[model samples]
Target: MTESAEVECVVVGAGAVGLAVARALARAGREVVVLERAGAIGTGISARNSEVIHGGIYYPGGSLKARLCVEGRRMLYTYLDRHGLPHRRCGKLIVANDAAQEAELTRLAERGRANGVEGLTFLTSAEARALEPALRCTSALSSPETGILDAHGFMLSLQGEIEDAGGAIALGSPLIRAEASGRGFALHVGGAAPMRLNARVLVNSAGLSAPAVAARTEGLAPEHVPQAHYAKGNYFSLTGAAPFSRLIYPIPEAAGLGVHLTLDLGGQARFGPDVEWIDPLSTDEIDYAVDARRGDGFYAAIRSYWPALPDGALQPAYAGVRPKLGGPAAASDFVISGPEAHGLAGLVNLFGIESPGLTASLAIADEVAARLSEAA
Candidate 1:
C-alpha cells in the first residue's frame, strides 16, 4: 500500500462552491488542498447556465436557498467591487404577458419582499414597456437587485484567494473513494500517481457528482446521500445585438424558471435553460450539445414577452446540466449536510445546489465552515 499523505483539509471539486470552501478554511489558518477531477476548475455545473446574480425572490420562505441567496448576492457585489472583477448590476424584470399571469407577478413580488429583497417594483404594461421599449407584458415585477457577473472571472478570483492563503489546488486529480480513518478520513485519489490522503477535514463539494461521491465514502450512511437527478438546460444565443438592456423573464414554469433572456457582461443576449431531465446514472456521460432545432420553440417563448423578436435571431449557443436532488414534478432546496446529519465528523456534503448557486456561493461556504466548526 502507498504511504498515505496527510493534509489538514481536502476539498473535493474545484467549482465555485468548492473554491469558496477552501478559501474560507485557508483564511481560518488551516492548510487546505483542493482536488479536481477535471483539467481545469469551474468546469462542472458551475461553468454552465446563466451567470446571473439572482435576487432571493423565488425560493420558499425561510429556506436555505432564500436566506443564502439574499445574503450571498449582497456579499458577491461587495467582493466583486473589492477585487475589481467584471460584473454589472444590470437588474431583471419578471413579466406577465396576459392579465391571467398578472397575479403570478404580484405573488413573486410579495415573495421577494418576504425574502428580504429590496427595490422590487410592480409595473404596468406601459410602465414596463417604457423601460425596455420592446416589452409586450401586461405587467411586470422589476427586481433591481438581480444582475449578472463574469462567472469565470469570479471563479478566478476565488482561486487566487485560495492560493494566496497558502492553499493548493491539484488539477486532474479525481477522488476515487474515501473511508473513515482515526479522527479524520482517508481519501483515495485516482490519477497517474494513484495516491492516498488522510485529511483531518474533508469537504465533498463535488457539485453534480456530490451524491455519487458521498456514496463512495466507505463509512458514510447510505441514506444520508440523496438521490441524484440531472436536468440538462440548453441555451440559444442571440445572433445580433440584444433587444433589451436587462434580463426579461416570463412567469416561471413548474420545473424551472422558464426560458428567459439573460445578457452576459459583453452585452450579448442569450435565452434558454429549458429543463430536460435525464437519468441520474447517465449524468457523468450526459450530452451538452445545443440542438439548433430547439431554437424554434425559443422563438415563440421569447416573442411572448418581446413581440419584436426577429426570426432566425437565435443560434445554437451551449448547454449545461444542473445537479438536482429531486426529479421532475418535484422541487428540492439546497442540502448542506454536516456531521450531525450523517454521523461523519470532519466531513460535509452539499447536494441539490442548482439555481442561485453562483449567487449563494459565499454564504454556502460560510455555512460549511460553521458546520465543520460545530463538528470540531
Candidate 2:
C-alpha cells in the first residue's frame, strides 16, 4: 500500500532552480513540496558548475537568458548580502588572444550593453595588461559585474527560506510518473517510502531528467518533449598559485563558454568545462569522472591567454554535465514552458537551463510562479 498526500504545488528536483521555485511558491502562500531523486539536494547539475555569477554578456538580447541573468544577478547580490552569505564581485576579463578575436569582443560588449548589463568596458592590450600583468591578449572586455559565490551556501539559504515558509523537501524521493488529473496533477513518487501526491501544480525542473520526466507525463504530447543531450565538462585545477586575481575567459565557444578560469570563494582558480558530448541512456548512467588525458587540450587553450602557464600545472579537478537541448554545433536558449505552451493548465517544464541557470534561478522561480498564478 502506498501512502498518499495532497499539496498545492509539487516541485521536482531540489536543485538550485527547483528550490528557488519552491521557495517562491511557498512564499506566495502555497503549500509546496519539493521532491529530489537523489539522497541530497543539489547533488546533480547544481553541484557541478563554475558557480560564477554571470554578467549576461554571452546571451542574445531579448532572450530569457539575458533578461533573467541580468535581473537575477542583481537579486542574487542583494540576497547574499542580506543573508550574510559568502560571495565576491571579484570581476572577470574576456580576453581576445589576437586581432581577429578582438572583433568578437566588440560584438559581445554591444550585446551585453543591449541586454542591460552594467559596467562593461573595452580595454586595449596595454590597458588590460595593466590590470593583470600575467594575461596575454590583444584586447579584452572588462565586466566588473561578473563574480563568483558559494553556490552551495546560496542553495542552502533557499532551502531554509522554503522551510521557513512552511514548505518541505523530500530527499531520495523521485517522481516516478505524472498524469494530468482534471486541472491538477496526480504524481506517483518512488523512494525508500513510496507515496502518491495530488498536487494542484507541478513543475518539472528536473535538470537533466526534465525531458525524461515530461516523457512520463500521460497527457503531455511527445512533440513537447525535447531530446536530452549531455555535454560533459571536465575541469582541471591549477597546481600552483593562480597568477591572476580575476576570472579569465577566452571568447565563447559554440557548445560552452570555453576553457575559462573561475575562482572559488577561497580565491583558488580552476579552468575547465571543455565540451565533450556523450550519449547516456539516463542520468544515472552518465559518469562524472574527469579524464586526466583531457588535460592535454587544456594546455593550448589556457596558454593562448596566459602563455606563462607551466607544464604539468593542471590536475584533474572534476567534471559536470550540462543538460543541453542541441548538439555540439548548435546552441539553445532556456525553455520555460507553461500552460500557454502545451495547454497543460498547471504544469511547467524547464529545458536546456544550462550556464547562467544558477545566476537566473530566483528570476526563473518568479516566472514559474507567475505562470501558475495566471493559470489558477
What value of lDDT does candidate 1 attain over all alpha carbons?
0.90
lDDT of 2 by residue, 217-336 (tens): 999999999999999999999988889999999998878888999999887889988999999878999999998999999999999999999999999999999988988777889999
For model 1, residues 132-251, the per-residue Cα lDDT tens digits are 998898889999999999898999999999999999999999999998866798899987677899899999999888998999999998899898888889999888899899999999
| lDDT scores in order | 0.90, 0.93
Off by over 4 Å in 2: none
Q: Tell me how many residue pairs clash in candidate 1.
A: 0
How far does residue 153 in candidate 2 sit from its true spot (Å)? Answer: 0.5
- What TM-score fits each model? 0.98, 0.99
Cα error, candidate 1, residue 318 (Å): 0.5
lDDT comparing candidate 2 with the true structure: 0.93
Off by over 4 Å in 1: 1-3
